[model samples]
Target chain A: MPDKSLRMRRAGGDGLVTRPVMLAIAGDSAAGKTTMTRGLVEALGPDRCVSLCTDDYHRYDREERKELPFTALHPDCNHLDIMEQHLQLLATGNPVLKPVYDHATGELVRPELVEPAEFVIVEGLFPLWSKLSRACFDVTVFLDPPEEIRRGWKVARDTSKRGYTQEKVLAELERREEESAAYIRPQRQNADLVVRFAPIEGRDDPAGTSLSASLMMRPTIDHPDLTDVLQSGLSRAMHLKLERDPDGRPVETLHVHGYVPREESLGVEKAIWSALGAPDTETPECLGRLGDARSEPLAIAQLLLLYHLTDAAR
Target chain B: MPDKSLRMRRAGGDGLVTRPVMLAIAGDSAAGKTTMTRGLVEALGPDRCVSLCTDDYHRYDREERKELPFTALHPDCNHLDIMEQHLQLLATGNPVLKPVYDHATGELVRPELVEPAEFVIVEGLFPLWSKLSRACFDVTVFLDPPEEIRRGWKVARDTSKRGYTQEKVLAELERREEESAAYIRPQRQNADLVVRFAPIEGRDDPAGTSLSASLMMRPTIDHPDLTDVLQSGLSRAMHLKLERDPDGRPVETLHVHGYVPREESLGVEKAIWSALGAPDTETPECLGRLGDARSEPLAIAQLLLLYHLTDAAR
Candidate 1:
């Protein structure tokens, strides 16, 4: 009945009401959004975290999209207004009857009720597409894999999991390129962190080497102190360097090497975990799970996000 | 983005934007809630008005309720919080993805998008159950037909249309009596108008005579000026008198006679319709329809509600 802010105030027992911390993971299709979200949610545990995808707000089913002139990347192809409204409700610690879009059937299915937990993680292509939606997030992230790498990942995923031919997935990717440039990529400017996972630009990696992660942390919110971790003799695993963003602004970027030994990356993870001051002494094993294997770089990236979520809850 | 009040202010074209006028028709099952809503929505036309039943907010399907201790009339049996939120949205001219309850199969089905027009008519069991819900309505009406008459109507309708046995309907009504008293009837105190349709007390009418309507207009809203219409030499069709309410408070009541000739009641209808100051000169033909039959009292009652809706929109 009352506005959310007032409701939050009234819910305080010691006159210190705290709303849920909201995180946004925005990226193009097959850009590892689900992988990033899965690790964070697993680390936080299901009781403390809830996740949803904005693709549920698609305006048309897969069959209906075949008749439209535009792909799903365009804002006009989705119910962005309703998505914004639902985001506001979730951010305010309210439950929403969230729409469900079934990827397997390519159909719009029955809606399910989603109650927000202490940490709300929203991942999809359009989480940061608008100002109102962007305002709903406390920490926003944009996944920025290289175009060639992302395309390869998409083809492999579509063929293996989604029952699509490599040619069809590639053609769909080609068709979505214009709208991705016009709508999706521009959202990178609004994110608090831009994360890119790829092989080093000028270096050749072994066939089985995992991809490294480059994280650009903007000064929009107070970030965790990583000065001690950088000097902990883990330079082969991670290092901080000054870089220029696309907007020609100077930013501090953290690079975590995937070629480093797992034990070396574990040292870096421990340093960041101690900086978090989390109640748990050991890092959660659920972090960095990619199917049956694990990636140390993903574990560290997720740990940094966990640090922010815990910091804001404070 | 913004709260409804702020959104309304920013929506102004001439700096006087008005939100949609909301009307709540609350009553027990088979108390003619749908009949009353049908007349009003038909009179206003589909382009300018939209109507939804709060029964759609039921938390359980009909099959599930058989196992629950309470009937659908209980507040706990419905998603009242979400219903309150949706009412707030519709009252502010915002669209909602409303849940659907299929009465035929007694199932909770897919949700449908509802965009409010100039007027929103909300009808069903618990629309007026809570103070917060009552506050969303510009005009509220509670239908209070006599118990015997309502039971008869329920039996006839359920048997003929819903494929229910008259014996089963009677048994169900008996089972629901306690909850109807505990949760439904008390909402009458919050309505702006309490309407009862039955034969006049201590009088015998012809075998086929229609039921008359007695409207108790509360002082919560400024009702239209009916002084001239009451004195327009139509006493046989309609008249106003002072009476004490169930709470022993003095109130003005309008009594419309169903036994009056059709031409005489039409004169009263014309008087009320003209008093609305509407641009249309002729009365709408769709009002007061009971399937293939019609009632003049139902027409006059609907016209009075239309007056309130138009007045609030101003």
Candidate 2:
């Protein structure tokens, strides 16, 4: 099949030009990608931002994957060609008939029509795997929580939402660890921002103390200036440090403190909201929700991505 | 009276030398100096940090100052010489019998013993006015809130706490403004950091949007690197902007946004907390309280000063 990007090319003299800012949030399963995407959609308003999960393009049902030698992290397990094509369509502000994989039932569902909005966020495992797919995005992010934290999240999610036993979830995670390492984790190198939310180091926090965040700001794109924010010294909960990434590249890491008072955290949020020039006077309530618990770092990461989207609009 | 610092100098002592990190928070009445100092004391722990209000050095009671030609902002209206001696003593880890000025009754009460801790935070109207006084501090901050905001705060504080009418408070502010401009405001020029907490520029927030803050990070002192915090793009609510101060000096200003989600502000606070090495998991609970409401910018300013205090210790 001809790549859909070719079909999406605007013909000369046609004068039908439409372009929406496209952002790709790529990560492994239960990496909080969808939750992060939801906050952006809410912050930008549903009417202006549209989101799609590329996991919907799974080649087989969940039970079918059991018979295969490889897990869903493998490219062969997903329809990367179609996902790339749809991403191309969305990038140019076009519509597509998209397939859906229902997570609860682990079954393929009927296709549905999807219209692109002013901002399009494509989030899933393989959105950044191919050069053609990567080209469709104006900005890209990779969620890279520690493996242990990710495992806890996945086990909880799979057990509660997908009806899998804790043992089954752990077994599956062990089974897919190699594929995830080979494929999904590599996407972090291509991301403009790599976000990791985890427990703060060297502190014995109370039971409800929020988890801290470490954001690796790669120099792949123009980022907002935060010297004023850091220098404002408004709250001790957040800070920035320079460090070397695993690939020996110089990267700036921003760590957000958790377990501070609620109002203090909001102070940082409003500053970010103002920076984005977003119309809202408050942060989206949909952010940071993991079941009943909330994550400050997750909300902040989403807000930064929202900044990129709204900034692109300007 | 024998100068405590002169006695502390020890012309020919063999050893027994120790020094305490001193921080000066100088500002006019109701500029939130005591509130700011409280947070730092809490963050560093009371055992390690001792705070004193320089207003305690008043040469005359409030009624006596009322009959005098000059207001409290005048150098002569305070025991500047004694304050200098005390500061010098505190700077080198010595104790002093500091006089107490009772704000409620407008009386010069009995003196109280003050022991020097690892960190000494001296806050009031004239802590940074003199060469000798300025030399006693390792770090200095000037709170320069807008006159309008200061007026409102003063009026509210005087009427409720000190038994003064709103009209009387306003008249007092006007009477003190000239002395404040000459004595208190000029101290801002010498400060390593100048903090201004007020409403965000050009935003009509609701009745309860926490006030925004601007901190001028002067290069006079070595400041923590905040490049990563700004680049992280986590909270658009906080940002660092380069701008010129009133004296035409180039300064980096950090602005913390208010009214954002609590989590967002915490993200910024956590980053700073992490930068400070996260010895304690929770932020100082006493921070961000401006009267009943909390100011994130105030907390951040305190935290930054805390960084300088601890950094000096190292």
List the DockQ of the predictions in order: 0.29, 0.00
Native contacts retained by candidate 1: 0.15
Q: Tens digit of lDDT per residue, candidate 1, span A217-301? A: 9888777777776876656567888889989877788888777677777777777777777646887788878889877778878
lDDT tens per residue, model 2, A256-285: 866655676676677777877664766777
Mind giving the per-residue lDDT tens digits that candidate 2 earns over B1-314? 01211221232211244678889999989998877887788878889988999988787788788789998888988777667656765665656556678889988754555788888889999888876677777889999889888888888788999999988888888888899888888999999999988887775274777778888999988887776877787777788888999999999988876665567667666667677676478766777776687767677777778778878787
Runs with alpha carbons beyond 4 Å of true place in candidate 2: A1-314, B1-15, B203-207, B278-282
lDDT (Cα, 0-100) at A83 in candidate 2: 73
